[model samples]
Target: MKTFEATARSKSKVDTYISNFMKLHPFAAFLTVFVGGPLFTLLAVAAAVYLIALPLGFIMGWF
Candidate 1:
């Protein structure tokens, strides 16, 4: 009986905490896509440029 009561109280506290967090920072959730999307695209472009340049650089070294 005591264990069940404690569990219920803990769950309620967690629920309240999550609700407060969401209310406080509603935009926090979308921040990942807003920030991460551009960062990932830049890394991809840098990798592509490196890959394309390696072969051309090697071929040019033969000349």
Candidate 2:
């Protein structure tokens, strides 16, 4: 019984925190999906290009 009450209280607190966060920073959630998605993709592509080019540059004596 005590454990059940504690779990309920914890869940209520988490729900309140999520509600407050949504109200406070709605744009943050939007930017995270839209802007951050593309930014991380670009970074990943850039890293891949660098990794591929490193060996090629060494072989071509351009390093």
In candidate 1, which residue ranges exceed 4 Å CA deviation?
1-28
- TM-score against native, each model: 0.49, 0.58
Task: Specify the poorest-scoring 10-residue window by lDDT in model 2.
Answer: 28-37
Candidate 2: lDDT of 8?
Answer: 100
Clashing pairs for predicted structure model 1, backbone only = none
- State the lDDT of candidate 1 residue by residue for 1-63, as single tens digits: 999999999999999997888678878745645876788899999999989988898999942
All models: lDDT? 0.84, 0.92
For candidate 2, what is the lDDT? 0.92
- The residue pairs in collision within model 2 are none
lDDT of 1 at 53: 89
